[model samples]
Target: MDEHEQVFQMDTGDYLGDCDYIWAESERERLRRLWLHHAQQLSDFYIKNESYIAAIKVQEKVQELFADAEDNYFILMKLYELLNNSGCR
Candidate 1:
């Protein structure tokens, strides 16, 4: 028997598959948080400058990324309210 085999008896394929699954999940989560941060920063900057339309666009673009997901609904609604109250269409 090989020295490596003598020390470790678990199936390598299963170990690799588990590792890949974990890495993929963590990577997806990291990307989601990153996008959310970027969207928030851009929206806040546009709103602070009184660019309500641009702020709404930013939120809408993020909504597209998430695709009808509940997480973005609140921000989208807030942006719409801001635009409506500002008379910016």
Candidate 2:
């Protein structure tokens, strides 16, 4: 299994000794929310920077974060289109 799957399979006790289950659950949820928030923030940052070339590069990296799928290709294509529409390299 991948590192992420292995981490998910581990119990609270495996990572945090004597931590309350409720607290662990909250922490996990908070982490997920923060990750998503950060991702959006990063996208906005790129957009505001007006660095279309850099944004395209970042979009390529983001595509790699997902497994091979139609959605992944669509996202990449959309990013490319956005860059092209912006008339930036």
Candidate 1 lDDT, tens digit per residue, 1-89? 23322222231222243465765776666756665676667678777888878777667766766676785688778878887888977
Candidate topping TM-score:
1
Instruction: Please report how far candidate 1 places residue 72 from its true position, in Å.
Output: 2.8
Cand. 1 Cα-lDDT: 0.65
Worst 10 residues of 2 by lDDT: 5-14
Query: Which parts of model 2 are misplaced by more than 4 Å?
Result: 1-23, 56-76, 85-89
Would you list the clashing residue pairs of candidate 2? none
As a TM-score, model 1 comes out at 0.60
Q: What shift in Å separates residue 23 of candidate 1 from its native position after superposition? A: 3.1
Candidate that would win on lDDT: 1
Q: Write the per-residue lDDT of candidate 2 for residues 41-68, one digit (tens) a residue.
A: 5555666776556545545544554345
Model 1 pairs whose backbones collide: none
Off by over 4 Å in 1: 1-22, 67-71
Ten-residue region with minimum lDDT total, candidate 1: 4-13
Clash counts for all predictions: 0, 0
